[model samples]
Target: MELTTSNPAQPHGMTWLRDDRYSWFLAGMMWVLIVLMIVPEGFDYQRLATASAPSSGGPISRMLWLLLLALGIMMVSWRAGLAWLLARVLNPFFLLFVALAIVSVAWSIDPALSIRRLIRLGTIVLACVAFVLMSWHARRYQNVVRPILTIVLLGSIIFGLVFPALAIHQQTTPELIGAWHGLANHKNGLGALACISLIFWFHAWLTREVRFLPALTGGAVAVTCLVLSRSSTSLAATLFVMAVLLVLLRSPQGLRPYMPYLVSMLVALLLIYTLAILNLIPGLGTLMAPVTALTGKDTSLTGRTEIWTILSEHISYRPFLGSGYAAYWTAGPVPGADSYAFVWRMGSFYPGSAHNGYLEIVNDLGWIGLLCLIAYIVVHIRQSLQLLEIDRHQGALFLALFFQQAITNLSETHWFSVQSVDFVIMALATTALARSLLEHRLRLVFGQPQPSTIGTSHGMALPLARESFDRTPDGGA
Candidate 1:
């Protein structure tokens, strides 16, 4: 598509509106992508008995997703072109991870399922790349992100209040009774959404990027949803993430140099504490038993430990490779094949996940894939840290998201997902991080100061989308 143009004879408001059409389109695509994946499935007790999550809406929802994604890809191709998007999507470590996932299909107990899932994951990744390109290149990251989150966050409250049967937890388990699932399938999902919403709006408020009243309202609603959801892990993760953000972003100037060391020490302490609470540290767990009980969970962590133990035994059977990418939890076993036995062992409470992200990877792709994942995470984090030197707010936002995902995965499987909100957000953050680092490097090498996407005051300024229309040496748009 060509750059939208408003003739000089047109009114100023008309010009502005014409110039911003791309921005509105970008935001609209993002809303569709995020909202469809995160929207509630209504309350279904039958889903609790099943091991896997339901598909991400019906055929119409998927068809719409694909249509938007195709348009986004075309826009990116025509405007910024494929080179930059490819650079971000085809990073070496990430490529290796994808390659491993593809290779796993060869050894998969269910090759058909593995290949199907790989296609789904690939489509999600492509959408993420297009999303990042449009948002970052156009300097509309916040414009694209905040409104979608606001809608989802606020809609959760409305849904819960007006349609309690669909939004509130039903009689699935004793512990989940009376809890609000909101716009998610489970209370924990709602808690996680609220936790992230709280963190994001709070950051906007702290940086003064957003005005007080609206930011305060967002944060307040987030807190209310979080409390009503009653997801202990999300609650704990939010507090820790907020504390870290405060120390890093709000600390005195003199303490800036020591911040890294302080943060490392704090993280180490938290890890040790978590290990003890989970009884992973031998005698320390016994000592921390009472403390764990106080948190409304025992060492079993609501039966997650038992699930992990069974999963570990199965993972040992494969050791290096794995049963298959997304094939281990089939609905039924092939005759004479033991691969789908986990579904039965998990009984009626089958959680479709290993309850641990790292373990989930191992169960699907084995130790080699686990290593690939670690490398991918490390590479992106290193780039994000480099971005910190160029833009604090952007870096801090990415870090908050990274840590939140990492922490939540300790007790939930939020990684390697194609449909979850967590996956979508992380994809955006990581892609943006890469784009920022690359742009910073290019500016330094060429000695040209690129215009800042994020304002010096941490606000985002929408650059004229007409910049994408700048003529190349060959007179291309």
Candidate 2:
């Protein structure tokens, strides 16, 4: 009679193991970093330093890098619904990356090389999907975004201050004609970084529980770094997002409570305008500093506009699929006798990137692919804007990210290569969350009992928290 068995109570941490939130958070981190490593964050210059082969960096390192990523994702994921939702949201765009690989099957001048590049692109996307499925939560999502802002701000500062100093230190040593190397490859990439980071910090300023001072300082530095990057697109985007911040401050019905934000924005705008009219804005210096440190006169943006013009002309050629993945104007030899005569030419210099992302896509993926990409992003941005309109904090962050992406894709220096990874992952996660939220709102409006969904407060947990979990552990339990 006394042989009754008792079941042990699960600790909170053990229960948390069953919680999709915890599993998803880990998955999200894997999604962010694994894709970044594979996509080659500095391909803008890394390809130049070494041969493009995965072997040039060594086969062992590349193999180990990918194997480790696979193992990590396998170890963490616990849910299948997350995977399917992730796929449903993102599978449409995989067609573009697959199109890159398919191009090699049909038309690679060097089939082997093209196949290799195609495989690389597919692997990156697949890895991104794996990470996104596991880590699809609003809080974990913030972890990935906030660090990105830091990296961009740090990279911008490093380039703005250090690159010029390095050039001056070795100007006469003659290692090269210029030294514009930031932590990343070029200013455009850094500018992309700045643009995204600016939006992120600006969101942090609005949504987080923290005091405003830290976010304000972060926003200023992000804007300064973006301006110093001297990318007109980045500058324009910063201003646009700043406008968004002002709107957020004023949109709340209780305007009197936010008088401080209104006053601060007005002051900031006035000061920035006054300084610019006086020709004192720092971006003006970025144009001259590189050459003045070495020679006398400012160098032209080194024919950037002319090169852009050349790429635009090429867009007419492939009006469909321009060239192929990683294919562009950079591959051809300048064979004319006049070509050899140009004194302005830098040594062995060639750029594969089209500088204009829209043109670049049209060249590589063809008209169909280009149209799909544009439509995909536009739809997501439109949705995010709607979400923000409803004052949903997570939706606002998505809106900020997509807005930055829409701007920086033009005249981008290095973003397309590195950012494909982050783009797909974020896209997968955002769409999943948005869709689930949409379904919930629809059910409530129809007066239908809400359908069960993971992480949904309906059925599983009350929308009103059972009690304050922050109270004493025993009390809450």
* Superposed model 2: Cα runs more than 4 Å off: 1-56, 59-61, 68-78, 91-104, 155-181, 252-305, 312-317, 329-349, 389-391, 413-477
User: Can you give the TM-score per candidate against the true fold?
Assistant: 0.80, 0.62
Residue pairs clashing in model 2 are 28-135, 320-366, 320-367, 321-366, 322-363, 323-363
lDDT of 1 by residue, 63-132 (tens): 8766865875675564464234346433467667777888889899779878877876666666666665
Residue 420 error, candidate 2, Å: 6.3
For TM-score, the strongest prediction is 1
Worst 10 residues of 2 by lDDT: 1-10
